[model samples]
Target: MLSVQLFHNFNKYARITEADFGLIEQVLSKKFVKKRRTLLSEGDKSRYIYFVEKGALRSFTVDKDGVEHVIQLAIEEHWIADLYSFVTKAAGNINIEAIEDSEVWLLPHHELELLYEQIPALERYFRQLFQRAYVSLQQRLNLTVSSNAEDRYRQLLQDFPQIAARIPLIYIASFLGITPESLSRIRKQLFQ
Candidate 1:
């Protein structure tokens, strides 16, 4: 059942044969994370890349003031990992936590390398995925630097309407680089 989302995502990039899917399944392990559980913590090495099959997860960092800044949110069918740590096996700066009780498929680095070696197409598939991720990150950074908090909030709503309904306002505010009170004000102004 979890493979359904994985297969659907992979199909967008490459034709995944049933045999390919079976081989891919062999390398994946399923894990359930409870809400608010930390899957990866700051200064810990990220050994696995997670694919969300159900529920939500987020990556964030706390500032010196101890304020949390959300970096990314991954819901169903999305992938989340500290890419630098995953690639270099270094301690990560971000923390990944489950925002809700979740089911995830984990692909270990070693198993991923083996799959890449055995199935060359898998390498290309991941490269495309990374390229897209890079572009999205760049676009997000652009928005963060150029847009006002209210505009950013609007874009967030336009992009992920489901998020507002599912996630708390505090988290959404942090993701927008605004205070929760500011978000409340903005929503009031927009709605009223």
Candidate 2:
């Protein structure tokens, strides 16, 4: 069951009402994913905004050379989705897969739209959410262009220490724009 406090927090930040909350609860559903499960695939329309409750998920895309590049990772309390596909109702370019057994709350776009109309505040909340996501994306792009691979890896580790222990080094490597072997070398050097 969704906690009232969580709802209150969201409402306080988003300025939604009780009736709107009830409607959102009715439309949203919970889902579980075992480790390695694929939540969204490239070329599929994204149906939900997934909020992680446990474990981790990674979103990535494969290049022409068949090399996978990580786009983002979401852990407990984080949200993951292909925003383009979710908002535009088009096929997604990225794939979302579970890195570990996970629990998620899924919010469908249409149902969410209903709440948005009935409560304009809900739309404001999502607008703020989009703004934050965009700002983070810009920061990541700046880091990728300006930082070296080792520096990028170090930053990721410093920002999300739990990821160092829970995620496979290879995935972390890809996320940091380094090859797995390169990440291994870095790890070895750091430990020494």
Q: Top model by lDDT, which number?
A: 1
Residue 115's lDDT within candidate 1 is 91
Screening candidate 1 with a backbone cut-off below 3 angstroms (N, C-alpha, C), the clashing residue pairs are none
| Candidate 2 local lDDT, 1-192, one digit each (tens) | 575544764665587677778878888788889999999999999989988878899999999999999988888867899999999999999999999998888999988888888888888977887888899888778888998877887888888888777889889888888889999998898889
For residue 136, model 2's alpha carbon misses the true position, in angstroms, by: 1.1
List where candidate 2 sits over 4 angstroms from the true fold: 3-12, 16-19
lDDT of 1 by residue, 1-192 (tens): 447889888878877777788889998999999999999999999999999999999999999999899988889888999999999999999999999999999999999999988777788789999999999888788998999888988988898888777888888898888899999999999899
Model 2, residue 141: displacement in angstroms?
0.9
Specify the highest-TM-score model's number.
1
TM-score of 1: 0.95
Clash-forming residue pairs, model 2: none
Alpha-carbon TM-score of each model against the true structure: 0.95, 0.90
* Backbone clashes, each candidate: 0, 0
